[model samples]
Target: MELKKLLEQQSAEAWEKYIPSLSIDCVIFSFYENALHVLTVNMKDQNLWGLPGGYVQKDENVDDAAMRILKDRTGTENIYLQQFYTFGNLKRSESAFEAYDDSIWNKQRFVSIGYYALAEHSQVKLRIDQYSNAVEWKLIETLPEFMMDHRAIFDKALLTLREQLNNHPIGYNLLPEKFTMPELQKLYEAILGKKLNRGNFYRKILRYDILIKLDESRKGGAHKAPDLYSFDLTKYNEALKEGLKGNW
Candidate 1:
């Protein structure tokens, strides 16, 4: 069967298995090549890209549904996920399915639960489900045209992430187990979308007391290898509870 036809058929089945007028959209983030990237999908027959998303099953809790959706796309259950916001602006997603019958589930007015997830870039195995032709990471700075109000959804997710930086442990899920101070700084800069003074960044991050300096340095560059460090998960979790003071 054709992809559109398959989607049309699923639209009928969706009403029976999933809650109507409710959906989940995930903004999965990763830090790679000194930039922040987001996972996106290209629909099979459309010239549009969108966040990886899915419907909420009638019997599942909303947070569980979001986790299931994230695992489906990223192939991991260990991602750091947060429920950031809800998007329900009028007609937010209805027009994307105008070519289909009004009864189509895709055409319904859905208020999406927004989630922001952080996964290590190397750990994620991007998967394309039945509805998408391509599932790939796009740099947050240079995203393709998005369908419906997905761009708005992405914008809001990014904003929420930035706001959380002051109080949250961000790089635990986004960075590798052992990373250089410069590398960690770059991740913070990527998320904050600004350049930070090296001295200030080092002092502030060290003061947080969430990282442990390893007895090693990164090897490869002609210049002196940078010192390596890893998060003290115990301290990190403690900081998460108490929240680090001050802002970027």
Candidate 2:
């Protein structure tokens, strides 16, 4: 059967199972190769890509639904997720369903709850659902055409992350358990879209007191081995609750 026909058949069932006119979209970010990337899926029969998303079930809490969706795509539940914004612009997602009848659940004007997530790149196991042809991480700087208003959604999520850097500690989820000071700084630089003074960055991060220097140093790099550090969960959690004191 054709994809649209298949969707039309499922439309009725979707309306019965989910809340009307509501959906969730996630911006899943990860750091790798000294760059930032976002998880995207290329929907079947469409040239454009979109953020990983799904409808909200009638009986499920919004936060739980978000967690469920993230877990379905990434194969992990240890991600750091935050609801950043809600997108309800007129005709935002309607054009994509233009071929379907008005009765089709997907044709409705959806009010999407936007969430931004951080996960370790190596830890994520990307999965593709029935509607998608490909599920992969795309570099933020070179994103392809995005479906509907997903580009706007992504831009807002990135801005929120950059703003949060001013007050909160980040990278516990994006980085490995043990990482070098330079790696940590590179992650920050990737998100902030700028370079930082190595000396100043080292001093400020140390002052934050969120990391513990491990005895071991990274091995086999061209340059001298740098010390490894891990987050002190207790202090990190404390900093998360009571906002950190300075800017980058």
Candidate 3:
């Protein structure tokens, strides 16, 4: 069946199968080349950009709904998700959904649950969802004007990411399996939106004892190679459970 027909049929009966006033928005943060980027879509409105989002099914768990929407929109699954915040302000959904029927939407105020995720930038395969085009990552600092409260959502996500990096070992998911100390430090700096003294950062991270240094180094660079490190996944997993912060 054509996607348009399917959408119309679903909209006709959406109230029966989906929650009318609740939706989900995802802040997919991608870190690469020592910078933080966010996944934004044109949403058929070339002038306005927003986070990838969708309505929730009536029978769906919010977490499951987030995973479904992420996979459907990005063609990737099993990415880790963290529920960040819920935006319930009356004006949150003021922007118009031009492609959607007014009768199906605009019937009620919407409350959006925001989720943040971290995954290697290369693993993401962008796919066109129902209303997005030219989907791509935009630097967090240089994002275009957001359509709704998406900029607010991204800000909350970034703050959560910084907290998680400090309290959990989740940041490894955003880095290569084996990485140089500089690369790891840069990732944290990018997410934190600040620079740290190289020596202080290195010393602080090393005390965590969560990295397994390897003799191998980053190759093919003109500069002297820095020692490579692989995450001690065993310790990292334990840290995720017990927490790792302020021990330095």
Candidate 4:
């Protein structure tokens, strides 16, 4: 009853229970230290990598199936997940995942729905499934060769994420419960893909009036400690409803 065998049997069963055309792909983004990264996995003997994804089951809701896949891959649940785009181009899966030994996978074409979520990097412990030989976070800007149209999917997901930041505070998922102002600004700079003026960024963010500055100071090294703060979720939600403008 090895996981590999179980997964192989499940792959056979997938032909019967899973949709022939529809699938789900997750772009889990995490802000680690000062850089942004995406979760990627490579199958056995395959040099290419792609996002965490799976097929939709016949009786299951697509959203539920997506959540299950995310939990199985990242060991994290309850994080907010948003469905962003559906990739329906013909031959989207052509020649993808070809290194796998499973014959069933080669028998069909798949159109995948792309979903995305952000999580605190420190909170996640990756769980590789039977199909993947290894898993790691890769820099979005310098990703390796991807299978099929996953490169296009990643690009769309990044664009969608940047758009979400402009209208929502969902980016908070990428940080710890308490953070310094510089930490928050660093996140914006990473997502917006540009540096911002320190004075301007601080003033714009402070105008939201949703952060609770704590008396504690950020400590790790000998650098001068900065005051720590946490966002008031109630006020944050209200501000999100009003939609945050890109002043930075």
TM per model? 0.95, 0.94, 0.89, 0.90
For residues 66-142, what per-residue lDDT tens digits would candidate 3 score against the true structure?
Answer: 99989987788978788989999986774554455667553357899999888678888988765666688988889
Candidate 3: global Cα-lDDT? Answer: 0.80
Task: Give the Cα lDDT of each candidate.
Answer: 0.88, 0.90, 0.80, 0.81
Query: Candidate 1 on 32-65: residue-level lDDT in tens?
Result: 8878899999988775799999999999999999
| Alpha carbon lDDT at 212, candidate 1 | 97
Backbone clashes in model 3, listed as residue pairs? 18-58
Off by over 4 Å in 3: 1-10, 97-102, 240-242
Instruction: Sort the candidates on lDDT, descending order.
Output: 2, 1, 4, 3
lDDT of 4 at 96: 58
RMSD of 2: 1.9
Higher-ranked by lDDT: 2 or 4: 2
Highest TM-score model number: 1
Candidate 2 wrongly placed segments (more than 4 Å): 246-248
Q: Give per-residue lDDT, candidate 3, residue 188.
A: 82
lDDT of 4 by residue, 129-215 (tens): 667778999887789888878889988988888888856666568878898888888888878789999999899888888789998
Q: Where does candidate 1 have its weakest 10-residue lDDT segment? A: 239-248
